[model samples]
Target: MPIKFEIGDIVHLKKNHPCGGNIFEIMRIGMDFRLRCSTCNKQLWLERTEVERRLRKHFRNDEEIKS
Candidate 1:
């Protein structure tokens, strides 16, 4: 099954960037996904297929989305 994520959901990515962070925010969704690094503020676009493969986990609570 494909993993699903929603806007404002906090997620951990499969790989960590050089900044030593793997967390990202699901800013946009569609044929492509737009993500923002939780630690470095870096943003990038990824294919939905690729994102599904790399999604590590979804936030269990809404605390992170409050901001």
Candidate 2:
């Protein structure tokens, strides 16, 4: 099954970013996704398929969604 992600979801990638951060926050999602790096606060745009392939894990805590 394809992974389902929502805006504000926190995700860990299979590889670290150039800034050495593996964590990213989902800012937007569509055919493409916008992500913000956890450590550097840098933003990136990636295709949905690429993001799905690179995703290692995702956090969708109920508490986070409520905030």
Counted clashes in each candidate structure: 0, 0
Error in Å for residue 6 of model 1: 1.6
Instruction: List residue ranges in candidate 2 displaced over 4 A.
Output: 62-67
Over 1-67, each residue of candidate 2 has an lDDT whose tens digit, in order, gives 5578899999888989999999999999999999999999999999988888888777897333222
lDDT per residue as tens, model 1, 1-67: 5555678778777988678889888899888999899899998898988887787677835543221
Best by TM-score: 2
Could you tell me the lDDT of residue 8 within candidate 1?
76
Q: Which number leads on lDDT? A: 2
By summed lDDT, the worst window of 10 consecutive residues in model 1 runs over 58-67
Question: Candidate 1: which pairs clash?
Answer: none
Tell me how candidate 1 scores on lDDT: 0.78
Query: All candidates' lDDT scores?
Result: 0.78, 0.86
